[model samples]
Target chain A: MGLAKRIIPCLDVDNGRVVKGVQFVDIRDAGDPVEIAKRYDQQGADELTFLDITATHDNRDTIVHVVEAVASQVFIPLTVGGGIRQLADIRRMLNAGADKVGINSAAISNPEFVREAAEKFGSQCIVVAIDAKRVSDQDEADKWEIFTHGGRKPTGIDAVEWAKKMVTYGGGEILLTSMDRDGTKSGFDLALTRAVSQAVNVPVIASGGVGELQDLTDGVKLGEADAVLAASIFHFGEHTVGEAKQQMARQGIEVRL
Target chain B: MRHVAVIDYGMGNLRSVSKALETVSESAEIHITSDPKHILDADHIVFPGVGAMRDCVSELRRLGLDDVIREASQTKPFLGICLGMQALLSYSEENNGVTALDIVPGQVRHFDTQRERSGNDFKVPHMGWNEVRQNISHPLWQKIDDASRFYFVHSFYVDPTDAGVIAGTSRYQHEFSAALSQENVFAVQFHPEKSQSAGLQLLKNFLNWDGQS
Candidate 1:
């Protein structure tokens, strides 16, 4: 393994503008995905992940064009997720200059889809994006379960165990997001990250709940995640990638500074 | 007019490379042309790629840009990025067979998984930012310090046969050649355009480089 711990900036693109509506709803214009992606790349971001929040409803061509436009400007590795369900979608994204394709709902519906896509495009190209939310139970045995449809529906599946299964099913990497921590400006769920990182053999990118620079460091050092991803912090000019990396280095974490 | 012809064989992110060059040069002309004449006529040439090594080499040969590149490297400044750098080597271990390029002496081999395994479960493709330790002094490293960070995204690396040509080295799981220079021919496995400040400095250094006549 030669890859370093990536510091990725995620973008939720809705109609070509980066938007952050509550729980992925009533999305308003945040900014252009291309402009935001270029800004992150310019700030020394390791990689960029673009989630087409409305791709499923808009169709494949729209996403492909957006990806093409983004790829034309940015040179770093770009991973496109959301509404990538079929082989054709994967191929289209790849052809449009996406280095990796992330699947979430499709993999949940069909576990074998991971293996099938990995077999077709190689494991390096497939990324499994897991959206999980913590559930409380009176039985005291309740745990976090996987959520689908933009974290709208619960699959009643244990996220930790499901992550392990995802890797076994040929997921090259895991992008774990905590629905509870998302957009909270509190911090990342270190426990959830550690559990998923321990369960998967491939690289695990800890997503959701990156309030400050220390959260990123804790996510990498304490959570043992291969990468740390944040959205609002970066999009809202809270912190640049270089600033976060400098903080990580100060905390005795090995980063490319 | 000082023009920089960026060889675009339909395999690279040339726009970023061109943008980086434009930032550094006062009169940098970025021409994404496959024509051999444009490559031969340019003041400098930058070969940029992010796709398969074999595909790029084959495309270069198909376009008869192989001879053009070979001729251009003799007098003009030539820099290869990522897969373009791999194509500058003698051969690559991709596509289940050895496709020879004969640009450099050594063969480009896939990263040794057995030898370069990290304890924390590192990923392949080596995507992201990493530091490059300067091994030899060259015009490219004019203002760059030791262990300068650079962005890399590749599965293969160059093994220069001549030690004198190696300019900088980086460690992933093990030490590997990150930047190489042999006369006017320079290559880097990392993408300087994507590397931000450090990368911009490198591009500026290259633009101001007075080594190649």
Candidate 2:
């Protein structure tokens, strides 16, 4: 009995409603985050993450209400990401019941914010979300660069080096997402995950490009991630968190099943 | 009327703690306070902390809650969590060695993943759910299976000088003290507030406990 690899289901919420398709399974009112969060909790999900993909300024406050409603009922750790720019945003999300906040573009713009946030709120709650994209193709040498603005904007910082720097700045966890495989169902960037995981001592969460149960297992076995986060497969009712854990357990990965 | 005061010394989130406790019982009053006077008035005190030991120590002294915690833990059902649990020890290796409350005779040591064999892909912060082997029977373990998994996130583990106080032990790079109990005070390395059903059950038992082993 040892530490089990965590299976996290990420919800991309837009304007307070879950922004994903509900065409897969028995889900009523796909926009209601509380109902979906409750369902995931019942499925024995290790943790739940809600990314506020909401863009409009007027609807920005909607995610807070959604977070507050979900936090009251769900007992596990909750993480809220997307648009976390300032320390006040972190406090607001935490006060609204989020256990951790993910900082993306803000960290790239001002690395000192990470150090300040970690000093104020502790590194356990400060997560540096790194969006990594391959700088070279499959046949060439493995190299990745940091991407921002939903993986649309590119930064010159090397993904591996940036991860190390973030950890130095008190980023307790690294949420590494492969821009190349994010929505393609191709699988996680194992090489990139390994590079970052090996370079730092903090927990690295492997996100993006999870197509099937095998991909989740590969994330832990190959990527060496402390946790695996997926959006589509689980959100669309194609697979449940319980089923994913079982699949990982069957593959000899220790999971809380 | 039972009241639980979750000590807030300018660190981490205390709402989840208060919220978890509130969910355990509606009749009991739960509030997060940095005031020592209000803390001592409560029936039970939950010391919840996160962040560096140096900061935790500095804040406790700055707010004069160190003495309050010592006094409160001696008489009531006091619960120390995460950084708070580490603070109960004499000192820690973090921040290049920081002196702690010295309540539980022990020295907090780092995981030292770089030096250890760490053949098992051992990582720092030891984050996530792991089985906690029960070393002694206690009220908090009520309705919870022995060796049950609890959520944890810390880089250091407690090494109590007095083995008798150890209630549970878990292994990462090596087996270390995961739970400690001395008189009326009980501390855990894991975040029971985030441990789900087993965690809530422990809190429920604490609400009903009378500080008697």
Candidate 3:
């Protein structure tokens, strides 16, 4: 059977409330996490991811409660990310009913932690999130560089190289988010997504800059991503998950409708 | 009230499986336990597992649940998921040839088909939703539609020796058994608990099924 391209609706949670922001700042509350997640589940979302944007010590417990509430109501797979610094943090999310734990800043800070988490809790449950930005003419030597701390600090690490390393280190999946395109609603960074998707042996999820249904199809076709993730379009009800899927099918892309 | 025992050897996600079973039944009792007595005495047993084969095999032997599982398979309705399905085989290529429960005569092998042959550079871990084509009529496939997509996350695939036991097949780079049915035992390589509507229907059907084929 051919694997169907997945449509994922991501929720950014801050202090127990589902929120949306532009480029990780200027946050605004969307709705309750559980309520939003249930709606996506009903709309035939293949999976749901909850990103704890706060990523602070005090807000950690809040994310756990949010994950628990959402998991109870939504039967689809749930991925929890943000502030997953250590094994304990990953354990906390999984114990709270998260099917997978996504590591971003923590993975960049300590790359070996990705392998450790993958080994401890099978690679199937470990997702490495890479936030990258394309370099301009000034840095001709590098096309893309890794960014940490919500795309604020830039590392010299190459995005494509980092993606290959994450997979070799046993990352089951890669969630590649483009800093240049995130929240812009332009479209996914097809060049970057294609490079990383070809570089890894696991599934790559193209995220950021998805404004229309065409972007979803482009992500799977041009970007070669196994899945496409978006927040604003789905959270605001611009297009339902069914509509996006119908558009994908019309474009000759296999999607579970 | 039918009591379903989800055999837990501390390997995979039991919460989602238990929660889904609870959602499917109003009067049935779902218990996640590693105790041998609870499994043997339960009306139905569901074996669920994930992670490495070496660890899974060791845990089952350490808890002495391997023998208990063997006995319960013959006495009641049994359902295995993911690694739990792999463990029912005779041996696995994973963990450098680990011996399994030998409940079913089969071997688990890694999907080594090259991309050049399939024309698609399919990734290993074969992670995501794929369609399961049913091969035979069974009670477990009751309300669920044929060729329904189920969520899968695994690197190895089981090849049962007897073709008669093969109940359903799925494609990766090539076709492999997705569901196996033998006597009172039925197992699947995908996670029905996470498959949404179609998966819920399968769980509900299992709750209402008897041990008979």
Most lDDT-accurate candidate? 2
- Across residues B1-213, which tens digit of lDDT does each residue of candidate 3 receive? 788999989886788889899998878999999999888989999999889998999999999999999999998989999999999999999978999999999999998634652244468888888999989989999877898999988999999999899989999888999999999999999998889998888888888889687
Q: What would the per-residue lDDT of candidate 3 be over residues A1-257, giving only the tens digit for each residue?
A: 47888999998888888877322222233467876787788888999999888746776799999988887777889999888889888888887889999999888889999999988889999999999999756546538999876688889999999998998898999999999999899999998998898877788999999999899999999999999999888776778899999999999888888
Q: Distance from true position, residue A100, model 1, in Å?
A: 5.2
Candidate 1, pairs of clashing residues: none
iRMS, model 2 (angstroms) = 1.7
Q: TM-score (0 to 1) for chain A, all models?
A: 0.90, 0.97, 0.93
Over the stretch A28-73, how does candidate 2's per-residue lDDT look in tens digits? 7777898898888888898999999888878889999998889888
lDDT of 2 at A234: 85
Give the per-residue lDDT digits (tens) of candidate 1, residues A1-257: 23456789888777665677312122243366776677777777888898887745745466777777877677677899988888888878876768789999999898888888876666667899999988866577536899987689989899999988987776778899999898887888887898787666567899988899899999999888889998877766667899998888787777765
Candidate 1 vs candidate 2: which has greater TM-score? 2
Clash totals for all models, in order? 0, 0, 1
RMSD of 3: 3.0
Candidate 2, residue A148: the lDDT equals: 83
Worst 10 residues of 3 chain A by lDDT: A21-30
Q: What would the per-residue lDDT of candidate 2 be over residues B11-52, giving only the tens digit for each residue?
A: 787878888898898589998899988899999989988789
Q: RMSDs, each prediction?
A: 5.0, 1.7, 3.0
